[model samples]
Target: MPEKIIVAGVPVDTRHFIGGRRVASPDTFDDVSPIDGQVLGPIARGGPAEAEAAIAAAREAFPAWAATPRAERARILHAVADGVEKRIEELSAVETHDNGALLRSHRRGVMPRVAHNFRFFADWLLTLGHDDFETRGHTNHVSWDPAGPCVLITPWNAPLMLATWKVAPALAAGNTVVLKPAEWSPLTASLLADIATEAGLPAGVLNVVQGYGAEIGDALTSHPDVRRISFTGSVPTATRIAASAAANLTPLSLELGGKSPLLVFADADLDLAVDLAVEQYDNAGQVCLAATRILVEESVAEEFTRRFEEKASALVQGDPREEATDLGPTIHTRQLEKIDGFVQRALAAGARAVIGGHRRDGQYYAPTLLTDVAQDSEIVQEEVFGPVLTLQTFADEEEAVRLANDTRFGLAATLATGDRERADRVTARLIAGTVWVNCFFVRDLQAPFGGSRLSGVGREGGTWSFDFYCDLKNTVTAPNGWNNHG
Candidate 1:
């Protein structure tokens, strides 16, 4: 049996970490485990007041922390990475229990990557250099400075990892941040706050506020002290945040919803295509970059569907804590019902399910694959965000590119092909920000990652991330005032 994670000496229902201290709230909400519908405990329920306090703390800590040397910031962030690594199992178990992510996935995939994100940014910051040039006999120096207190709002899916995507670079760039993890999955994020403090972060530099977005989200965005905001979630929420942030003219990085596609040409390795399609069902298909729409060459469409169905059908759905479970429940009952509605509407529109197509139990939706879905169908056009994939066939390369770019989303697109020429050709035309050839979900720390269209506003990885959390200032110096006209 796995031991329960002791967060701040409490077994569950963790409190918000504010100003480096655990704070309780008068109002609380029950955090039910999506794994088995069991009540984990009561999590702190906060509102505008809590959001204000968190922003105030971050605001206070920004100047001194920002003034800290680059070498020291790197050292502290490296320590944070080490701290997270040391508490892997404890944190992993907590995340899996709270978010319904399989324990194995957390152990082998997500948690390790979370630690690496911190370490990667830590090293990258050391190499961040100022640009210097001479213009009109004056030496000009450009440097990226901390953007001050910022708000980082992450979604429920892949909670800790996504939070790290925003948090690591913000801190690395010497900005203080208040992170609001999705109310549904706050356990690991709170644990990260504790780890940061234990790793020697200054009090109030990194704070975690736990509450529903409706109550506290706008407060964080609209707070006068918050200089920038980074959010990853649905398109609707992103619009709302954008409106609020605009009130202050706050700079924002929004990673909104995605209806990303996976393209497989006829000449491509059929085996690899099938494998990648099956892999899409991981994380219950709740990924922002998930292969929601599969575009395959008409020649191999039938065979590809047959093999994919077999593999997807073999995926086991059970308790997320179990090591062998492949697919887990949706984050909540509402998500499951939403997924079911998409499938039912598709079926009514004459699409046929190749395999498991319906919702099971309370929140478990089987890995479902649908065929004959119209290009404009709701399931094809919008993001279902479940373990459901819709298949469409394209006649030629031109049609494939056209069909792939048909949606409003332009977050991620994957193409599986053996030919490099074809890969280069299709990659350039795809509207998505990230295009993978012969692969899916392969990420590099140095690359700029985000969406192009309704998917997101700005990039959030590599130097782009460091740039986003900071304001660039250019200074020019000369021995005396020299007028070119004179």
Candidate 2:
């Protein structure tokens, strides 16, 4: 049975939102819940026109929002935080219904963190503190201003958290925005817009647009009025958006994918490394920086593989909505096929699946660990973006670094070592945007997060995001006795 959900106080098919109004799609597509392949609902299918309208609405609203006082805007943001808190249960239920995530996971983890992000940015806005930049000598520095409309394209895996990563900073910098939440799971983003509206955010400050990416995302990326575009997803898509934006000289912020490596040194904390390694791949190795590759010393490689495979084999795979399910079906059938192809490719190349090797049902793919994957194999070189991981063993510290930095991706890297010398040496060499010396995904809102090379350009989740999202114009005054005009 399809559950009835609301967005912006209006009933939407599958609860997707587009424009500032409530409406259903002319044609609907089944948004199947990943758990058990249960059909979630017939979500409306919006085309390019809907996407264009969303951009137009966002463009219209940018001027008023930019002129609004920062403090006032901050207060409205605080209300949105409160709304998210008040509607926590409702929001969690929608997420659980729409996604395969456990309700407990939603209630306990996702909601609170989202509220925290909203509050964190609100506090950050206040810290802007009426701008008291010091000017030395003849230079005069006043307050910097906002750019204009921004379009945020986020993915399904982390709908709200990633959306907040862009929205919070962009708004805090005083720019209005158009948000294109991933079509697969648009519920959270839709409801978030409603919550912002209820929280007294002036209309047009934020416009949530939902639809297929090729049409919607393309419209957003090439929208003439959109001064900034910040997106998080695959590299090929990021490359396309960058090219489109370059045509207009529009600034873009990209948070692309990664095939991050996790290094476990000889002198490292064995228990901690083992524990994190096993648990890291639990979310089906579907995280952007999930330490997909483990490059360990040859001595301990056998032990690590044994423990890792043992853990992977024992994990319970099923419905994400069920509290007992440790693992669930992937988001879609296409992803399952992608993962299956990687496994087959590995097997054909003489690689072995120590734990999981095949599919159970339509969307249910077992958590898999591939051993003896060649450096040139597709799985090792490309971002599988699924539950599959390829294992490798390294000889010395230098070999460890080489293996870790082998991939073209530079998103995040982790080091496991009890020895300070080994930890420092390996950490310094890992070519990732974020490196965890003794941890994984211990994200701080205050820390600037982004990637290097193909991973992305520009930063997010810090004061730096606000700085880059806005443009700075210089004003120079000439003194009466200044150099004579020639």
Candidate 3:
């Protein structure tokens, strides 16, 4: 039996799920909780051999799974969603313990979204439409065929939610998957495997391997059998994976890093702008789509900065389990150090720290705000991926658009303006995958999601997801009279 530990009163198993069974590795690594730096348990350490085994299982299972009826696949995926809903409380606690996100956010928002991901994709698959046309007495039809074994490498920052964002769609399209959860938070993925099994998903249909990216990521990505690769993480890592996948000419869908901007116009509602600014601190500022760079209209820059600084400083930072705590600790000491380093360097370079600029306690960095930084500075151009925000002022719409599109990363951006025409005109000019006006992070599962330029390649969500996970083949019938004459 695999080793089990109790977290938030729920027992969590820390082992790899491959071939529909819990497989133990020769060596194991400790899974320390970021909440208090306590060792949650020892997780199986998988290497190339384990990666090969998991891939083999997925390859063996792909044909039958692909041949399964679309209705049947949809039913199984719905069951998976149902299973997730039944254990929402347990999953929420485990994820909070594993990743140091606020318990309330996970319970109220993230976990529920995870279930919705499965349910939404399942229903969408059944009602999916295809293209068919008739011309010159011949008919042409387009059909989506499932690709073979797919490898999914997910990031630690929104562990299970992000994982299912890809998994649900891949499985719903009849592709088998080998998911590799980030090493820092592998507990919930283990639980997810068990949930899928209970929901009637066949063995080898969904296998998970837990370990560092260096250990098994290459083995899975470079495998000859892997037909599709979908990854969500850093740009450098994605670059390496792209290089490896190039060997086989394997198709890839990458959702990479971002230093997204949020523009606040002078005519915008001050209260709503302030609320949206503070929200960048959500998930400890580890969000890819977060508006970390704030460009305020010159007339309202001072008022907006003061309000943002005051509200950010007052955020309740404490144990994630506490309901009143608005902020949780960073994922670990190293991540905390990295976040602090970004702030310290900006200060040394003549920028002003208007509010927070230091670590408060164990793994808890203060919510930070900076101003008077040059537009071209490293702190403004690069992605900090922490609870840090930088303030800048712009003169007009053209300047706002310029500053927003100045960075190499273009995952997402937001605009806070009361002018409807301005919203339409400016959003059209912004270089982002998703643009929001008077709102932030409001996502519909049916809409397209992903980034552009250095942010990412290809889109996912709705039919865009099926486009990446399946192969579109067209069939044409012979003209009726010509066939008879021949």
Give candidate 1 regions above 4 Å deviation.
Answer: 1-13, 479-486
User: What does the lDDT come to for candidate 3?
Assistant: 0.92
Residue 460 CA displacement from its true place in model 2, Å: 1.0
Worst 10 residues of 3 by lDDT: 477-486
Which residue pairs show backbone clashes in model 1? Answer: none
Best by TM-score: 3
Q: RMSDs, each prediction?
A: 3.3, 3.8, 1.7
For residues 1-486, could you state the per-residue lDDT of candidate 3 as single tens digits? 357888889998788899999888988888888888998888999999999999999999999999999999999998998999999999999999999999999989999899999999999899876767987868898888999999999998999999999999999999999999999999889899999999999999999999888889999999999999999999999999999999999999999999999999999998899999999999888899999999999999989887877777788989989999988989978899989989999999999988889998788888888998998998999988889999999999999999999999889999999999999999999999999899999999889999999999999999999999999888899666463563
Q: Any runs in candidate 2 off by more than 4 Å, and if so which? A: 1-19, 23-25, 129-136, 474-486
Q: Give me the candidate number with maximum lDDT.
A: 3
The models' CA-based lDDT, in order, is 0.89, 0.76, 0.92
Candidate 3's displacement at residue 43, Å, is 0.7
- Give the higher-TM-score candidate: 2 or 3: 3
Q: Of the candidates numbered 1 and 2, which has the greater lDDT value?
A: 1
Task: Name the 10 consecutive residues with the lowest summed lDDT in model 1.
Answer: 1-10
